[model samples]
Target: MGSSLLPEEFEQAALGLKSGETRRFEISLPADHPDAQLAGKAIQYILTLKKVEQPRYPDIDADFAVSLGIDGGDLERMRAEIKENLERETQRCIRLLLQRQVMDCLLECAALDAPRTLVEQDQRRLAEIARQNMEKQGARNHNAPISAEMFKERAERRIKLGLICAELIQQHDLQAQPEQVRAAVETLSKSYQAPQEIVRWYYADTQRLAEVEAEVAERNIIDFVLSKAKVEQQPMSFEALAKASQSLFTICDKRPEAKEGPPER
Candidate 1:
């Protein structure tokens, strides 16, 4: 785990224990942790060791490619596809980070009080989406753990930013370019069964076109904020970007999965 992922005084801590040994310790979290609910909390952590062994991965051969149903068992094409997917994901992360930066600037400049009705509506909508996502992930809970009240702060911020974006779009006469809209449609339709048909569907409906227009308008606002703000350039390695975006879900992974595994022999 990276330093950011580990609690203070836990990173690279010595755990001098043989295989099959167990240890328990206390973890202290900082007040400004990403999970605000867990801030300043003390957690008891237990480490247990099962049989530790190094991981063995299969070779990158035609049989592997054929099993994955890609490039007709061509290794080079498989590599190319993997690279393309990674680059696309990295580009998405860059856009999200840029959006956050722009939002922070805009929020600092504007004083906003989101309408109570809109905020309540947004809170309900967000709660519903969370419930749906949890259900999709095979959660068997009859009721969602999150309440609409839990979404109030986020909903208020979201509505306020939306109002600001709408004002910026109207005051500046911002229009979504046709080419940009088409590009967006193309990007969104790539994963569908029939991409061309999906593209046509987006263009065929005026309501959908308005949705796309709003997306482009929001992007324009981001660009406008970036242009006005004092921006600094920092070069980042591809490895760093990938690491920054990596998610480790301990959902049925190995006990000593690549971390405190078998001693090197």
Candidate 2:
């Protein structure tokens, strides 16, 4: 059995451990340490648990149906719906995965250092978003606030990804058509009781219409990317795919006063 050790004790234990034996230690860096770059100038983390168990899922059948508040017959219908949804979700996931791979390839092929100022600007934007989200959720900080240096790193990565994606979109000449936008709107309407009313609401606002159009453009780009790349299809139950896709692609209702710009990711 393993014994728990405090940071100071762990450091001592590490000194005596055999070459092949596992060991751990905890250490603190001063705020003025050479490596310190952020405003707060210090960070800390606790590490433990060398191994963890993975949970196994039980079989999905009649029992699962009852648990989900439906009879077996109704469950069959629900399963079908879920499968359809999952298929859509998997496709989207696969598309995102492919995009990341493509971006990585491009970044490697053409290595370049971006301007630090631009990166910092993007970092500030992201930090503002994070701050807003934390405030909205009413979370209390038991530790120091987020730092500019930390956010700058995150912002740089986002800027890099955005530039790569933009280049790819332009290079491929991918554009969303009016018909595609109409079809997307029609598909969105099916979920509402009054499909026409939903359609009207979407069309009545120019911003909302533009948001839908952007979505259509994104879908078009995904389709184009998939066509260029190799895809391996694995057989998934329709119920699983439908549920997954619905969760992936489900659009939220626009606030009455919300002025839409490009569709959100």
Candidate 3:
């Protein structure tokens, strides 16, 4: 992004430069950069402008619809499909928002010491997940050094939440029942074309069945929390809801590291 300065600085330097220009520069990254391996490190960079071009957009015609993979190149049909997809995405995001609020409420109500063993286990798990995601994205250095400290805060939070959920589940007898699990499975299958077939597929595998049961139990916990907590509902436009959910998701994905050592219990 830059030759002799930061990425933003390099962007500024690139302005007015003709194509095929080359520049060499060095810059130091911030300590809080998401990639711990390169954080606070000064590195040399060589930038070459291979090409510059204006953006091109397809015309809003049948060809555009066909490019979107809509059969028959029906523009109206494409719009309808896009609308349906957006509606589903909005609904899913709204549910995630509600679940996040419930979890926040639960964490506020109870604080416990996160076991070191559990924290380490979850830290490794999160790190592995991040690595796999990078690999899936075709990252050049998928196995690049990643500081474990990056996941410590998130791992501890997860451990604490797990402990709290386990205690509440036991005390309130919130174990997922057979009927409830079946209902959960049915609800999940509704999104599929062959709902009954999906339901049967889940029931056919113990592991799949157990995953739904776990979700049912967690949903019960969220419901229980919402029941006890003082809840205020605010109507949000689809745009606002989507923005808020995306912000929350970004925070979760970053998993900022703790600035200080773990507090004493």
Candidate 4:
């Protein structure tokens, strides 16, 4: 087992222990240790080696294909499905990369001061969003203070982009049409199971519909910007692009499965 913190002496003493062996040691925690309860304290720790288990993987054969519940136990079909999933994921990553590039280009070309009021409001919103994300990831410190200052630069950038997008939208009449919003929702829904149901779910609520409309409008802005901007197309492998997007992309709970278009809601 590996630990973030261990006194060298304690580790050395425990190194020779076999299964079912036990050892006791004490060490002083650093003053600024992250765990408040253990900080600046001498603590005794008992190490025990439980029975070790080795991982065993089954061989990929007819039985393995059957175990995966592939229709007709066909390995070729499974492989094709996996390829389809990979291609879909690759396309999603490419879309995100394009959006990021478009935003970066806009930031470089446009010059405008971010309004203080909007920046502050966005800072608060960003701070809250960060806190919520941390909570969702099982962070224990609910009371931990998240400073809005940490998001000031991001908020300012967002404000500037919003202002620029607004101006462009107004000047070019780039507002999302009803059909465009519906198409966007349907396209997004196709990635999930029972996609027609998902489409209906989106249209059932006005707020949900509005969210899709807003996203469609933003996508229109990206398309308009790309039309005007000089873009360099760089070829990259799916694996490399997926790796590059890891930091920026937040994986949703559900993996995309449905490939066919959903019935219109």
Cα distance off (Å), candidate 4, residue 235 = 1.4
Model 4 clashing residue pairs (backbone):
none
Superposition error at 262 for model 2 (Å): 15
lDDT of 1: 0.66
Number of clashes in every candidate structure? 0, 19, 2, 0
lDDT computed for candidate 2:
0.56
lDDT of 2 by residue, 35-137 (tens): 2233344334434544444578867777776665545636676687577656655665655454445444555765666578777886666555556556666
Off by over 4 Å in 3: 1-91, 247-265
For candidate 1, list the clashing residue pairs, or say none.
none
Candidate 2 TM-score, C-alpha based:
0.53
Score residue 151 of candidate 3 by CA lDDT: 74
Residue 147 of model 2, lDDT score? 59
Better of 2 and 4 by lDDT: 4
lDDT of 4 by residue, 124-203 (tens): 87667667667877989955878887666666767787788789889999999999998888777855656789888888
Please report the candidate that would top TM-score against the real structure: 4
TM-score of each: 0.66, 0.53, 0.63, 0.67
